[model samples]
Target: MSALPCPCGSGSPYRDCCGPLLRGESPAATAEALMRSRYTAYVRRDEAYLLRTWEASHRPAALEMDDDAWLGLEVLATEAGGADDREGIVVFVARYQDQAGVVAEVRERSRFARQAGEWLYVDGETHP
Candidate 1:
């Protein structure tokens, strides 16, 4: 079977992008990669993966995946979130449709930290 496109908008097959990360087979190498995998996790409604990748300080007790349908993800920019960086930032936009079919978008500048060779999501600043 052919691989599906990654929801992270990475233009690569899921197996080559976020699939491994989501499956706990590999850790995200960079902050941007971690951000992309997080986006994919949202699309797949993989709450466990989300929680695992989240920083302990910011991780919520649980995630609720209701009726909202995630449509797409767009990565806008990145700063200092390379393989060797301890800290990184990623700006992105996520689009979704609610129960009423109303389209909505959330833009955010997210922070990430690398600890013990793993990238963890810290927090995000949502854009109005």
Candidate 2:
């Protein structure tokens, strides 16, 4: 059977894109890559991967996956989230439909940090 497309909308197979990362088979090469994987985790309701990739300082005690159905992701811009950078920023808009059938978009400027050769999500500032 063929693998489904990655929920991150990377135009690549899930196995080729976020599957390995979600499975802990490989680490994300860049901050944006980490961000993409996190979005995929949300779609799959993989709470473990979400917590694992979150920075320790900012990681919550636990996560509760919501009922919203993730529709798509749009990466608007990125700054310095490269393999050689310690810190980077990614601005994106994620769309979803809630249980009540309300469609909405979440726009955020997320910050990521690379530590011990691994990229971790730090935090994000949501835009209105």
Candidate 3:
């Protein structure tokens, strides 16, 4: 069974939580910290971190998130995953601001994979 009343308010819980992600053990947390950190990377324009964490099969030729457009992040939910239940998904919403300071949003259901026990971001299904 999945954890409930997720601490991040994503409808998931602590044990089945983003726990691993928070511990830096799982690419996807067993909580929301991993997703939050990833969002921070976008705001900080940390392309290297992003690239290093992306799965090779899905790594982009030129990946970028508008620095000025990135605002903050919120992890909605996560699922148990993996070869040993190590794979997982993070449902989230990333908010940002344009150069004009206009607010924009990138709400997406992001997929994350654990390779060799390392959590590498795979991709996402973006929501408008």
Candidate 4:
């Protein structure tokens, strides 16, 4: 079986791929970068970064993470692109261990919004 690219593939090395974005680089010219950074946020458990990117209406008091768990991301797809008004649609599955040391998966279709001149994570649909 062929191994899948990093959860936020974007066809680039995980570090160079999402590093720039998480470091404040704009989404990839092709919309892939946005998807990747979102993954990186999960990997690093950057609650502040995640909150800053989330739209206010949906923003939570704080983002949560399993302190003892490590997370990885895989970006399945991204669609709806544009330079004026970009929309990043990413399918990702996050893998991590729970308090009991059981491995688990979280699948979601995330929606992103770029308001004014910044790309922000909006919300998503969870499946499984």
Candidate 5:
């Protein structure tokens, strides 16, 4: 079977895109890349991957995956968060449908920090 397309909308096969990151085979090279992988983790309900990439200061003790059907991801903007930058910001919108059949979009400006050459999600500010 043809490899499924990456849920991160990277136009690449899952194995070539976020799959490696989720499987702990590779580390994201940039903050934007890490953000995309995190979204993919949500889509697949890979809570372990999500927690592993989250900054320890903000990392939750556990993740509770909701019954949201992830539809798509659209990266709107990015600041810094490059391979060499220690800090960065990414603004994006994620669309999903809840179990109750209500569709909604989450617009967020996320913060990321690179430490020991690994990008970690710090937090985000959601928009209404």
Candidate 6:
């Protein structure tokens, strides 16, 4: 089956953008790519992919994602996370609609690391 548009707002279909990465068809080449794929994972409720992309040091033992309905993702900026870089940062805003039908958005600057030729999310500091 064909996938939908990537929730990461790449304007490309999920199959072409983050789908392959999420399905383990390929590894994210950059920090921003990892961040985008993670957001898409949240939308798809693929907790396994979420945990896999997370750094072990910060990865939680378990995740509970049954709450809010994720609406969309908007990547704000990036620094240093490239194919050759060992570390990188991505700034983004993710919008969600709660069960109450109230909409909210969260802004974060996330850090990532490249280990064993794979980029993984380390941590993030939310913006007010």
**What local distance difference test score does each model get?**
0.92, 0.95, 0.62, 0.66, 0.96, 0.92
lDDT of 4 by residue, 1-128 (tens): 12334446456565566666666654445344565666667767777667776778888997667564645666676676456666777677878787888888888888877776667777889999
lDDT of 5 by residue, 75-119 (tens): 999999999899999999999999999999999999999999999
Query: What TM-score, computed on C-alpha atoms, does each candidate reach?
Result: 0.95, 0.97, 0.68, 0.73, 0.97, 0.95
Candidate 5 Cα deviation (angstroms), residue 48? 0.3
Lowest lDDT 10-mer window, candidate 3?
Answer: 1-10
**Residue 24, model 6, lDDT:** 99
What RMSD, rounded to one decimal, does every model reach? 1.2, 1.0, 7.3, 4.8, 1.1, 1.1
Kindly report which residue stretches of model 2 are placed more than 4 angstroms away from their true locations once superposed. Answer: none
Q: List the residue pairs that clash in candidate 5.
A: none
In angstroms, the error of model 4 at 117 is 2.5
Better of 4 and 6 by lDDT: 6
Q: How far out, in Å, is residue 40 in model 2? A: 0.2
- Order of quality (lDDT): 5, 2, 6, 1, 4, 3
> What lDDT score goes with residue 92 in model 4?
73
Clash statistics: count for each candidate: 0, 0, 18, 4, 0, 0
**Candidate 2 at 116: error in angstroms?**
0.1
